[model samples]
Target: MEKLIDDEGEIYNSISPKVAPVAVQNEMEPSNISIVTTNGTADNNIGKSKTTISLPSAAKFTNAAQKKAPWLKSLFQDECSAWETTKCGLAELIGTAVLVFLGCMGCVGSMGTPPSSLQVSFAWGIVVMIVAQSIGHISGAHINPAVTVGAVVMGKKSLTGACVYFVAQCLGAILGYGLLKVVTPSDLLLASSTSPAETFCITDLHGKIPVIQGLLGEIIATAVLMFMLCAMWDERNANNTDSGVIKCGLTIAALCMGLGPYTGCSLNPARSLAPAIWNNYWNHHWIFWFGPIGGSLLASVLYRSVFSLPQCSLPECQSLNTQKAELYKMMYGHGDMWDTFLSGMAELVGTGLLIFLGCGGCIGSLGVSPSHLQITLTFGLAVMIVIQCFGHISHAHVNPAITVGSVVLGIKSISEAAVYIIAQILGGILGYGLLKLCTPTGFLSSGGPEAASTFCVTMISPQVSNVQGLMVETMATMVLMLIACAVWDIRNASNTDSTSIRFGLGVTCLATIFGPYTGCSMNPARSFAPAIWNNSWLGHWVYWFGPIAGAAISASLYRIVFGLKTHDKETLTPISESIHLNSVDTDKSEVIINSWIQYRVHLTTRVLTLGKLIRIRAPYTRKKVLNPCDKFSHTIARYKSQNTTFYIPISLRCFSRMNLITDLLMRFEEFQNQVYRVRVSCKHLKHVKQSKHDQRSKAKVHNNISKV
Candidate 1:
């Protein structure tokens, strides 16, 4: 890629047609132009170069685009299309597996008769930070079945992939846990008293928590989970999608770790089912599943309909390679705006599973405090792990309001954000439903009022003034939202900011500090879910309205007074660029200029962002386009001692879109032309002489697969 006049240019590559229907060389007309794929002397490249004038000069393009032109339509056959559902589907399956195995395992394995709730909670938190970094690259890490369903509905994935993702998640859970059983210490398992009831129950209190009380506890907790899922990490922010999941972990852990002592937090059905199956308890499982699911639906619908703006405008045709590079394509292959929403919906549903586990642990009969630190730890850890496990696919909002807020803030595109919200609600319902099936009343006669207290959303008796509680809650939420906005900001999220993930840990710290008061009901949607199910709607308005208002205020303040900005929103600063791809559709809408090439790309990037890589392809023959990374590399590589080789796979076409390919013989800072790449990697003879160390000849021969 080269910037021609007016900061625009062209790049040239010497290569043979790949997957060509006709012999490319045979079809060349009298006026022929083909790059020589080999290293040539400076004289060979420039000394005898014929810089002659031509009769018909047009913009330089690859053979793939030529096929799309109507004039040459009959000259070629169709090229392979890699941006198919099958690819995204496979990604989703693997992503879901990663999330479930790690997240759920953290919840079950960490709980025991003697354990620290705070430590357990961090387990989940750590999982979110680690797994997201790894799994995000695969299928967008939709690890949660619910998230997969949502993204599919949002048009991020084909329906086929979403279905496959759910199945994959369930199977993965069984397999992951089965493996854990083999590796887990026998003594640790013997003392493990972890359960939904035990984790949330207070040891001093005794008796069954009325259904209404238990239900209300779940509602607010799940609502808090949902709101964070929606508002904190939407890619619409200036950051990465995982940012929202990261916030969810912190917020949920706050409730589970600190508030679990009051009421059981059964926010997910899968959590309930897993423990119930393990413990053989089946009582009032319906409340757990139905309440949270219903609450999730209500919040999703309310958020979508009441408070939001239109989302990003989505183009119909998205290149697969481009999507992969931009997002974490863990198990679920990546998708564009439409598909991303679908993925978010899958996250919402998967969150239901999380609630089932965390909340169920709180409600599990044996979960009473002092002796049950392990239960509290299990609850918090569950959240941490799930966020890590499912951060990629669907943005893992897991809550409708977070998705809604993303839209309101112009983070999400209008294309399919609704699907994600809906899927989350449905998934929540299913999660709770499964919980109901697993827990029958007779199973937990041991759990007393103390246990019931753990799941209750009660306020601490600070004996403080009304203003104090309001101020405390307000300020806490403000700080949380501010951090969330910062993390979600695309500019920051897309860049290297380990600090954002730490913010999530910070929220957990806040819970550790403020757990005694206000119950940290940071989200109203959480309160809403269980309240409706258990007929515990008392003071529900406080949980719902208070946090939202606080969040809104914080958002406005951050966006206005503080001048913080999200990626797709009104931003505070703009970086200059040395080169940019002026993407335009051809008259036929078939020519897509996409590829990764070495070129002179002149752009001022505040930071390197893989998401910004340009892609240009007509039919096939893709290349990696230039973005900030190229500029940074040129600037940084000069001081480095070792020479590194870089390779881009042609299969991921979109990733190469708008790639600024440079001249093969001459190194450059930023500039591109069609004459470049005339002699790259076409002819590499592996003639290695006897040496003490392995020669680099073999590596050069496989340049296409190597990276510098």
Candidate 2:
């Protein structure tokens, strides 16, 4: 008789009276069993019998089980459902309908003497904000076809999904307008002599605006909108979504106010299409479609290719060592040369665009000068738009002063700062040259002979001396640098959703307060450009010297007062020591393990309570002998019950031996600090106990000597 044992610990006995004793030998494969039997004699009637059985491997059985039931496999998969996509599309449809209905109702002239541009702009902006906030999570609230197109170009949406979104948006828009028509009076829908259109909100060129100028206006305005959307969608700005809807609404309002006079600011093709279909007004309608679509494609592609930051995998992002290495590389200026080149180009283009748009807004013809408020809003919004477009790529330091401040703060190396400064200066000159080429002669010379040395030149007023002008510029630049430093501070990293808006409004505030004194030229590059182009360098040194001094001082002060210190040594030492202590005794091992368990319990409780730490003081129990696998599994189940995610090392999860558990726990860094602290305390207690025992023994020996 022979016995065979299986992996499950079940034994099987084989008996055959006619056969000789059977011999069983273990094979290299655990699943393979071999049995051999020989006859009692060569001439005997009984013959030898050999039987071999091969059992299925556990892995093979598991794979077969998984394949047999696909639903079981899908339980662990993270794939999105078809219903989720349908929900998104439905949300888009409803969001678009709401936007159009509210926006067009606000534009209805029949309600009164016709609302002012500012009123209509605010209405539309508020409506957009409301709709976005309501449905943003469900479908991203892409009420505009241009936004959908931009998402497609950025690879954020599939082609089929985008097509569905477009169709839904169109239908929603049409439905919204139809509902408006149903509610409004019939005479209100008719065209008046002043309107000359059957529809209420048909977008068309105003005054004597040429078709090409209107087209270009629409394209530029829509491009700005798309750029802001792209910035909001970027992964680096993932945490900045709290006020994203408000930003979008304000951006739309600003675009409309700035460009409404020329092109009606129809940045959305669907918004324009709905009204055209209602009133059958198609004159120059192609501008609305081609302009927005073209601009969306252009801006989306540019942002994705040039301004988007590289994203790391989850493992890399979670690794402290990798983060530290990258930080060190950046601080030491050892980053990729190609990235540096791209950053330089971004700075160049960003500065050039700033100068062109900002200075262009300053142009006034004849007696029609732009109002102070207009100038303020223009420069502020221009700053916001430029930053939104290029901030992720190069930090959007369009000024030499900001570059200098960055160098002082250790955010940029000397070489990188030099590259940025050169780019800014060159960009400024190029931008001014372009502005001069485009502006009419009298417009560039708007401020009369004395004040019209050149448009947008940073010159001191008659009441303010060169010294006063320098002080004003210095103070203003200092404030701006302080804002930059705050934005770059680690404490405020998660609160960058409205950075561009904050900067824009800050510029507006400073300019409004100090414009009459020195034109509020806090940027040396901005002042240098007009001075260079106009060949007018009166008190130009003040602009350069004041901003640089202000930047250096502000950067130094911010670093001294507000910088967060990194404790790399303190954070890394415990982990290293724990990893080295692999041969601890059973008592020390138990101490370490118990300490780790306590730490985990505390951590889990704190997380579950949303930062409220809960204290648990339970004595260690040894009623049952549990292996590491059981302990780990129990801990994991407890964590899951509290809705906390805990990851145990795979090796530790299957550990069957105490020594194996100790070895793996020594290498585990999560609870290493607490474990090491407990271990040291245990050793100290042991030393104290040994000293007490020795003292007692010495006292006893002395007592025996006296008694004798």
Candidate 3:
């Protein structure tokens, strides 16, 4: 009969009803056990069935059960969290909505006697900056669909997640435009429907701006925007710090300002599509989608593949890093109460000065209409003065954007930054309060929104679309940040003496170009303080969003082109200096440096401690020593801990060999009448081992006998 066996290998015998237990068979070897059963086929009449089972040895079975677990799958799940995806999508939505709505409001106010580009820029730039600051912590505020595509192509985001973001951003854009429509008058909307304008969806039948040129402009501008974004976000880049998101907003604002006049600077597809859909204007619609996407993709590919930062191999740079680490640890990890207080005060005082001087110019101009140059200079000069006054103290980072940028580059600590920002905000309120004291109440109220604009960040025209103003601000802020980094680069020697003047000139230049459109506020603090004090929040987000985006872009560009290398030659240096065996036996050397002694001493006595040889000259003219032996030993121990090295100068012709002891005693006694003190070098010294005490004794005796 055939045998039947279960998965556990317990065999059953149908032919033998009273068979040995399966356990007894299992205990025996496989060859010793046998199972007998009925015939293979089941017999219906007899009701008997048969089966045969084969099994691997228990050793082999246990091994097959102990295979490696699937760790890679678990890791993948951890890396891609469902919560993170949802958060990113939501942030994109809010960020886009903020950018679109404020930008539209700025456009609504752009139609005036002169059609100021400055007011339009201000409205758009601030929106970008604020949105970045608000939601940048979540989704990176990639409100533009072009950016989303670039991110995905660069492998920073998953295709599915990026698609989700794009959908959210488009919806957010529609929502922003809807809000703009509700606030705008129908008559004004009709007059400035943008269907007849050549802003976003180029409707110009004239050949002045050929469709090709418009497309090229979009490609170039969007390329620059994407290039900056990639540089800032690259983890390999040393300069891509904590401030990356804000800098991105600033970079966009700068690009927007510079390119607004040409092809309307529609660097974002979502931005263009939002308003186009609202007004039912679709002239040359392909340019917006094709140009930005193509440009951004090109930039992302080129930057990721072609560009790299310069490496540093200097010993000095290594030493500098060590010192920097010490300083950083002291300031952040173990900072005393006084340092924190000083840093806070520096920010407070510096910001106060900036607002008082900057906003004063704007308010004072109420009586006589100041030119854009005057306003720009006022703001730029204010920044310069604060920078110089507090540069050493607080880094004079009166602007929050600059502070964030510095932190990202690893130049500042987060706690210090928090304190600085808080101080500056409070300082801003104080500065505006002081301005109120000087200006007449009637003048402040008489102009209403027009008058309030002088003391606040507001839109001045309504002809430009929110998208158009945002683009202008983005371009302008980008230029401002680019120049700011250039001037601040320590490697550029020419910038050393004229940093303040150069920075002031740079800001003034930006304002002159973009001030008429949007007030040219590259600094968020400069905008926020005035707006808060004046109680004017219209289009305020543009100021924050634009400058921050622009700055983030600049941070990336600076890092890729000029950031310091992570691996340095100095870091490879041995932690402690190695002893030179060859130098010790050289007859050419007479004096040795005693790192323990701060001041120079003659070389007469050679003492070897723990294998380190130290030569000391004692001017002994009398029986008593000028310095106590215990005190000298303590000094040596202290110097040893500090890694200091000392060199002693020796001269053979100064004394006869046989009279060395007598001469040294006489000299030391004579020196006792004078005040001879020791000095230590500012730099740390390397350790040199001294010989054993018994060895030193033997050497002295041998020298004395030889001389005799």
Candidate 4:
């Protein structure tokens, strides 16, 4: 008998009567297989036998080993294909080249009639849109180095990729301008009647426009551009991409039109660098680079940290989102200190921006003073921009009057209101100080031969009395407060799409109508800043008293007449019955319970869980317990009639582990509250109408009796 074992651990037996076993021939390589043969006699009755076994080859064994470990193979693979990276770089290069070539070509006067500012602005805007649409899928169409930096900061692009894009963009800009120079006539490229000498498309400050002011203008313009980009890139806005290209184009055009006179609105360093290199004109070139890059960095970080939606994958991001939500609830729904510091900071920065931009636009440069219309529009648009940028963070209450109004409406506590006012005043002062630093001494104040008034100071007309000026300020502020009330009304919550624009136009109208009388100083902080800066205190008391008085009166009246009544008398009556959980699923039970509580109660409800016990609480009362593991079938629900706690028990397995149900319940409650507010407003309006009708009837009867 003989026994043979193979590599698979299977044994085979062969028996022979002969003394010696048959020999086997091997044809494979020695290293490929290992074989052992042995012959022995177990007993006198058994004959000699041989055993043989086969082993796997070295190559096969190595392959099998590699299959067991995948990371080893992945370690050697490239992160991105070289060809794909090259293609992306090339796309950025070409896109940037196209942008420069087309954008500058429009500014060439020799091609045709000299293009107006409007034409030039629209040309750049349209070219940007065209390039974005063409190469947006490839390399994200980052034609500007500033945009590339922003992308890197946002983690949308790797550092190495950003470096590649930056180099490509710069080279493309140079190539594009070089090509333009070749095609355009020498007269147009050089000094000519239409084009300034050594300027071409090179961005520069207007005559008498201080370098600091120019720098500031470029920074502000680029920041706005970056803000728009961040908004477009937000995950929450993922579904709103159809009109992104158009909106971007229009935004650029608007910026150019607004800031072109001051700094040429060179929001792209690459775009400005191209013309400067072509013309060999480097005056204030650093401003273009530093301003755009700094602004892009600032805006990108701000949006990511404060404004953008949180990514749940990151713990810090989730925490940030929670803090922001809590802050919002504290400000609008309830009171808390979750993020009051951040809110105050936002108010401070927002107020500073409002003052700086609004007052900066008032300064006259060179020999040309801004028109009344320009000043009016400037202040209006400044307010609009500030509000749009900081509204989510702090409600952009850049005005003391607005803060005061919030206090009267119970949206802010007295302490919170005080903090906001102090921040606003300090921010205004700081903004004016920065403005004075940038402005030329001659342009800092009014009283040149052109009869320009003090820079942004609200002055009463010499012909009008202080009392009359006070009335003008008071009435203007009253109108402004009324607008705020309408915006804050719960009934108008869904109609906030164009709120910034509406406020802008409203300010413009007020300034246009009442500007000559009292400068329409509807904001005390706005008026106080320039007065402090210029030391012009004539009729200053009127500004402070008028706006504050107007805000308080308007807010109080609006709250009583049009606002939601949150007192016990107006609270919705809760259901006074028992809720039985019989054969309902977890989700359905939750929905039914939430609906019952939300529709019946007037308070905001919150649900919390600890182990197997669930606690439900309203902002106005203590917590109520619900045992999820208990066998109880029914519980009394008396929250509607009185503010007290109650208990209910049900199976815990029916509830979801996720917070999705809780979010849905909260949203449902908010919707119900909005509906309730609408109903209350309608009822009040009906009562007023009926009272007027009865009074009219009584007056007619009295008149008839007197005639008889």
Q: TM-score each candidate.
A: 0.42, 0.62, 0.38, 0.60
Q: Per-residue lDDT of 2-75 in model 1, one digit per residue for the tens?
A: 21222222223333433121112211112222222212101111222333211111112222222223322322
Cα lDDT over the full model 1? 0.42
Q: Model 4 over residues 77-195: C-alpha lDDT tens digits?
A: 43556787788889999999999999988877655476656577779989999999999888788899998888766757766677788999988999998888888776666323656
- CA lDDT of each prediction against the hidden true structure: 0.42, 0.64, 0.53, 0.63
Q: TM-score: which is higher, 3 or 4?
A: 4
Residue 34's lDDT in candidate 4: 16
Model 2 residue runs over 4 Å out of place are 1-82, 108-117, 182-194, 197-200, 206-208, 309-334, 356-371, 429-459, 530-542, 560-708
Give one clash count per candidate, in the order shown: 188, 0, 105, 1
For model 4 the local lDDT of residue 349 reads 73
RMSD of every prediction:
18.1, 20.2, 29.0, 27.9
Instruction: Report the CA-based lDDT of candidate 4 relative to the real structure.
Output: 0.63
Candidate 1's C-alpha runs over 4 A off are: 1-32, 39-341, 367-380, 399-405, 413-429, 442-473, 494-504, 568-708
Best by TM-score: 2
Off by over 4 Å in 3: 1-78, 110-115, 190-207, 236-246, 308-708
Please give the ranking of all candidate structures by lDDT, highest first, separated by commas: 2, 4, 3, 1
* Model 3 residue 642 lDDT score: 19
Error of 2 at 208 (Å): 4.3
Candidate 2 yields a Cα-based lDDT of 0.64
